[model samples]
Target: MTWTDATLEDLVLLQRGFDITKAEQRDGQIPVISSSGVQSYHNVAKVKGPGVIVGRKGSVGTVYYCETDYWPHDTTLWSKDLKGNDAKFVAYFLRTLNLDRFDTGNSNPTLNRNHIHGQPIKKPDLPTQQRIASILSAYDDLIENNRRRITLLEQAARLLYREWFVHLRFPGHETAKIVDGLPEGWTHCSFAQMAQYLNGFAFKPRHLGENGLPIVKIPELKAGILEKTPRYEGSEVPDKYLLNDGDLIFSWSGTLAVDFWNSGAAYLNQHLFKVTPSVGFSAAFLLVAIRECMPVFMGKAVGATMKHIRRSALDEVMHLLPQGHILADFNHRASELYDQVQLLRAQNQKLTRARDLLLPRLMDGRIPV
Candidate 1:
C-alpha cells in the first residue's frame, strides 16, 4: 500500500474542540488534551475519543492520539471524519504530513479544521493501513516495554535500599549488641552529616540560552533524578555557578529530591544545590534514601506559603545508619543493579534517538514504509 492511496481530502476533519474556560478547567476529573499533552482542568465538552487529535492552532503540525476518554483543548483539532482509516492509522498518517506545508496564518501559522480537513494525504487501503500501523506499533511496543522495564528495575533497587536503610534490617541486626533495640555501633545522623549541601548561583532569565552549559533547574528535578535541563554557556555563568560531575544536584527551594550528575560539566541554578556525599558514603545510596524519606519530610514540612525543605530542617532530621559491613554489602548489591539499570537506560536512550530520527523519514514517503 502506497501513500498515493490516501489524500488529505479523504480525511474527515472534525471541528476544533470548544474553548475550555479557565474557571471550568479546575476541579474536574477530565483529561484536557492540549497541543502539548494531557493537562489538568476542563471547560469544553468532549466528543469522539480513543481517536486521533491534531493541533489545529497554536502548534500547527503537532499530532496526538488517545486510547481513553479525553477532551481536546481549544489549542488543538479533533478529527470528525475517520474516512475508513483506523483512527490510529490516520493519526500516524497525519503525523507524517508536513505541518509547515499546511500552515496558513502567517503570524500564528495555524491549521484550522477547514484547512486540515481539505489537506491531501495519500493513504493506503484499510487493511494496508492496519498492517503498516502494526509494523510501526511493534517498534512503539518495544519502546514502551523498555520504559516499563526501566521503571521496574529502578523500583526494585529503591525498595531494596529502603528495606536495608530505612527499616534498618541487615546481616548484623541479629548479632550486633543492641541499645534501645538499635545496633550498638549504629547512630542517627542528619543529611548534613552524610552530605554537604551547596547552593548554586543566580542567573537572570535573559542570560540563559538553549545550547550551552547544562543548567539544572528546580522544576526539572523529579524522583531524585534530573530530567529537563537548560543550556547556558560557561561565560554566561557566574564563577560560583560551576558544578563538577559526580555532584548530586538537588532542588533545594521547591522539590526536595536529589539527583546525581555523572555527565559533562554543568551549572546549577539558584534554586539548585549540590550534595557531596561524605567520605565512605555512596552518593547513589544517599539519593535513594532521600527519595524514600521525602514522604515523611513532606508530612512534617510546615508552611502556608510555598512548601519547601530548608537545609536547616533537613539537617535536624535523623538518618538511620546501617552497620558498616551491612551497608557495604547493600551498596555492593544495589550498585550492581544500578549500574546495569544505567547501562540499559543508556541503550534505551540511544534506541529512542534512533527511532525518532527515523520516524519522520518513514512517515514522509522519504524512506519507504
Candidate 2:
C-alpha cells in the first residue's frame, strides 16, 4: 500500500465558517469559529456534520471530526469539500501533517485555507483510504469505550464510598450505639486532625526536566488518578515535598480534585496540597474521604483572583473519624471493590496508550492497518 505522487490540493479544503460578531449575535443558529477553532456560538442557521475541523490560527494544526451537526466559528476551518476523502481519514492525515510547517510569520502562528489547500498529502486510492480509516477508527472506538468504562468504575466507587463512609451506613451499624444520632463510635474531626497536610514550595518552571520523578499538578489529579507524570529535578523539589507511594495529592483551587500516587518519588508545586495518612490510618479509605470532603471545604475557601485553601483553614474543616474497630471493618469490606476499580483503571490506561502509539503510524502507513 505505497502512496506516490499525492498532493494535498487534490482533496478539497472547505474554509467557510461564518464570522458573527458578538454584538451581532442574537440567538443565531451557527457556531462562530476563527483560525483558533470555535470562538463563539450562534443559532444554527444551517447545519453540516460528519466533517473534519482544523484550527486555522494561534493553536493551529489541531484536528477534529464530527458525526453530528456543528456550527464552526470563523477562526476554524471546516472541511465540507472532502473530494471523496473519508472525513475520519482526513482527520488522521491532518493529525500526521505538521500544519505548523505552513505557518505564516505572525506574533501568533496561524494557517489559513490557502496554506492547507497548497499542502501535500501522501494518500492512496479510495479503498485503501477506507481500510486505513477503519483500522484507526477501531482503535478510537476502543479508546472511547475504555474512557466510558473508567468513568463508570469511578462513579461506582464514589457512590459506594459516599454510602458507606459519608452516610455512616456501614454494616453492623444497627447494633452500634447511637451517639448524638451518629453511629456509636463515629467522631467528627478536621482534615488537619485526621491527615498530615503540606503544600510544596515554588520551583522555577525552567527547573523541570522531562525524565525525572513526576511533578504532580492540578491537571494530573483528575478523575481520582494521575493522567500524566511529567518529571522534574529532584533538587527543585524539597525532601519535605517529595512523596512516597500511597500519598494522596489534592488540588485546593478550581474544580477541587484528588489523586493517589502509588509510584516512585514525586513532588508538587505550590498549587497542590499533599496529604499523608496519619500513622495507623488507611490510605485508600482516606483518598475516598478527601474526595467526599472536598466539596464542603472548597465552598468555604475564598479568593477572587484564585481560590485559596489555607492550611490553617483546612485544619478546621471537619470529617467523621470512626473508631478503630469500625474503621478497620469498613476498609475490609470496601477493600475488594476499591482493588477491582484500580485494576480496571490500570488496564484502561494500558489500552489508551497502545491506541495512541498506534495512531500516527497506522495513519501514515508505516504500519499496515
Candidate 3:
C-alpha cells in the first residue's frame, strides 16, 4: 500500500447545496436530498448523478450517496467534483475525518465546507481507491439485498393476512355459513379483547443513564437500541415494561405501527405499548390486523400537531375472529413468513456493524485491499 500527501480540496471539492421549500416542490421522480437524507421528491434536480452529500446543518456529519440526479437541500454540502477520484472511496474516507467537530460553536450547529479544505491528508492511488470502495460496497450490497427480501417477505405476510382475515376468504370459507356478515363459529371482538395492550412507562430526563435497558419509544421500535440510545439506569422498572425478544410492540399515539422487538432487553417508553396476544390471538395475526386498520387509527387520532390515538380507539376497531382451529392454522402460515423478515433484519444489523468496524481500518490501509 502507498499514500501521498494532499489537501482535502485536491481530492474532492465540497459546495453548499441549493435551497427549496416543501411548498415549492412538485410531484416528480427527483429526490430532495437533505441533511437527514431524502425526505421528499421534486420535479427538478440541482446536482447531477453520482453525488456525495454531507450533512451541513441538523443531523450534521451524516453522508449519503446518490446514483441519479438529485436536488440537494440547503442543509447539506455536496461533492461538486470528485477530481478524478472514486466517489465511493471519497465518501468512506470522509467518514473517518470526524466532520462533526466543525459543527460546534454556533447556536445552530453547521459544517463549513470551505473551512475544512486546507488540512493535509493521505491519498491512495486510483487503483487502491477503487479496490477499497469495492470491498466496502460488497458488504453494503448484500445488506441491501437482505432488506429487499425482508420487505418482500413482510408484504407476502400482509397480503396473506388481508386475504384470509380482512376479506374473509379463509380455507374453509366456502363451506362455512355466513351469519350476520361473519362466518359461523366466528365472533367480533374489540382490539383490546384479543391482546393485552400495556403502555410503556414514562421515563423523565433524570432517568437517563449510561447503561441499563435502552428506552424503546414509538420511533425507536424499528432501529432497536443503538450506541447513542438513552437507557434507563435509574430506579427499578416494573417487570411488565421490560421488553423481551419477539415481543410485539405497538405505537398507538403518533405514527401508529406494530413491530416485534428482536433487539436485546429494552425498557418500553411512553406512547408505545408492549402488546401480548390473549387466548386465541397470535403476534403474527395481530401485526397484520393492526397494519390493515392503520388508516382508521390515523383518522381517529386527534391533535393539533402530534396526532395521537385515544385509548378508546382500540374498542372502536373490532376484528372478526374465527374458530380456534382456523385461527391457529392461519397463525402457523403467517409466522413462517414473518420469521424470515426478522431473520433478514438481524442479518442486515450484523452486516452494518461489520462494515462500520472495517471502515476506519480500510481507510487507513490497516487491512490490505
Compared with the true structure, all predictions reach lDDT values of 0.69, 0.70, 0.87
lDDT by residue for model 2 (273-367), tens:
78877765666667677777776778788888888677776677787767788677656655555566566556666766676687778766788
Per-residue lDDT value at 10 in model 3: 87
Worst 10 residues of 2 by lDDT: 220-229
Better structure of 2 and 3 per TM-score: 3
The CA-based lDDT of model 1 is what?
0.69
Best by lDDT: 3
Best by TM-score: 3
For residues 3-47, what per-residue lDDT tens digits would candidate 1 score against the true structure?
564447586556677677666675655678887667675534486
Pick the winner on lDDT between candidates 1 and 2: 2
Candidate 3 residue lDDT tens string, 278-330: 97778988888888888988889999988889889989988877888988998
Q: What TM-score fits each model?
A: 0.73, 0.77, 0.91
Rank by TM-score (best first): 3, 2, 1
Q: Give the TM-score of candidate 3.
A: 0.91
